[model samples]
Target: MNEALWALGRGTGVVALLLLTVSVVLGIVTRSGRPLLGLPRFSVTLVHRNSSLLASVFLVIHIVSLFFDSYAQLRVVDFFVPFLGAAKPFWLGLGTLALDLMLAIIVTSLLRRWIGRRVFRVVHWFTYALWPVALAHSIGNGSDGTSVWFLALALASVVLVAVAVAWRVSANFIEFGNARKGETR
Candidate 1:
């Protein structure tokens, strides 16, 4: 029973991380205005939006399972406030902070239309920061952090996000270069 709960918590946490990784990569790819994975623009955007929500759902399950797990000893307070836990304070705090950042992102995204596109764009940029924080937390705090499968997932996520970011940066530079050429002409 306890073992099952522990497994559930760990599994959900991993799933959430993967989903979040995909969401972030998709976001960067979508914003780059380049064709991604042979998918159309609408499909890419839809996948990005849906994956984020699914990631949030899995994160909730992870937290709830850990909160209830006798071994984890996580209090509700520890879930929201950073660095107050008895176990793995620093890493757990990072996780808490990541969650807080995601919460802000989620809320602002929901109200994006009302908040205006400019503000939404600014807030959406936080996903890049959130990804690294969440990654650090997963690596530092996960019990299976060193397991082969976990390591593989982590490595793949890092590569995917790195590639997406690099692609976006290169695209921006190309656009800038073209604009400079136009200005000279």
Candidate 2:
């Protein structure tokens, strides 16, 4: 029935949001400089990377299900090209841009060996770009954007990314401090 399909679509969206939240948390907790308080390095890194990949998988499912569900009115074009959605073209265009960025990051990651570390590292910088793009997509076009769960997830992602960035900055500061101390010695 139509109702059943709508419920399924909503459920899929919810799952995708949850997965994205987990991915962001894992990423923040496993950063080289700010790993989770007591967890072993290898374990945290494993979980973080795998969780991110899982989130990406869920994202693919979420996008695909949009086409199947009659309620969302998602077009294939809206997934690839920006500003083409029948509803709120600008917001949906953000989703399309996010998808493209994700695709580029995924492809480069999978081909890292062939691409070589220097080139791969350059492309990897785009991963940061993907997060903000994805955040905008979820906030701007997500159907459940106002729901408590959605808001929590969005805020968590923002906080996690913020913390990771802060950790990195603090690390640089510490290195600089140590270098100065060494020079004084």
On lDDT, the candidate that comes out on top is 1
**TM-score winner among the candidates?**
1
Q: How does residue 178 of candidate 2 score in lDDT?
A: 60
User: Candidate 2, residue 47: CA error in Å?
Assistant: 1.1
Candidate 2 wrongly placed segments (more than 4 Å):
28-34, 172-185
Give lDDT for model 1. Answer: 0.90
Each model's Cα RMSD: 2.0, 3.1
Q: What digit string (tens of lDDT, one per residue) describes model 2 on residues 1-185?
A: 55665666556656665665566556555554444678786777788678778778777777877777777788888888988988888877887887787787778879998988888767766767776776777777776777797788778768877876676556354435565456552
Pairs in clash, predicted candidate 1: none
1-185, model 1: which lDDT tens digit per residue?
78988999999999999999999999988887777769897899999999999999999999999988999999988988998988999999999999998998999999998999998889888898899899989988999988898888899999999988888777354445566456652
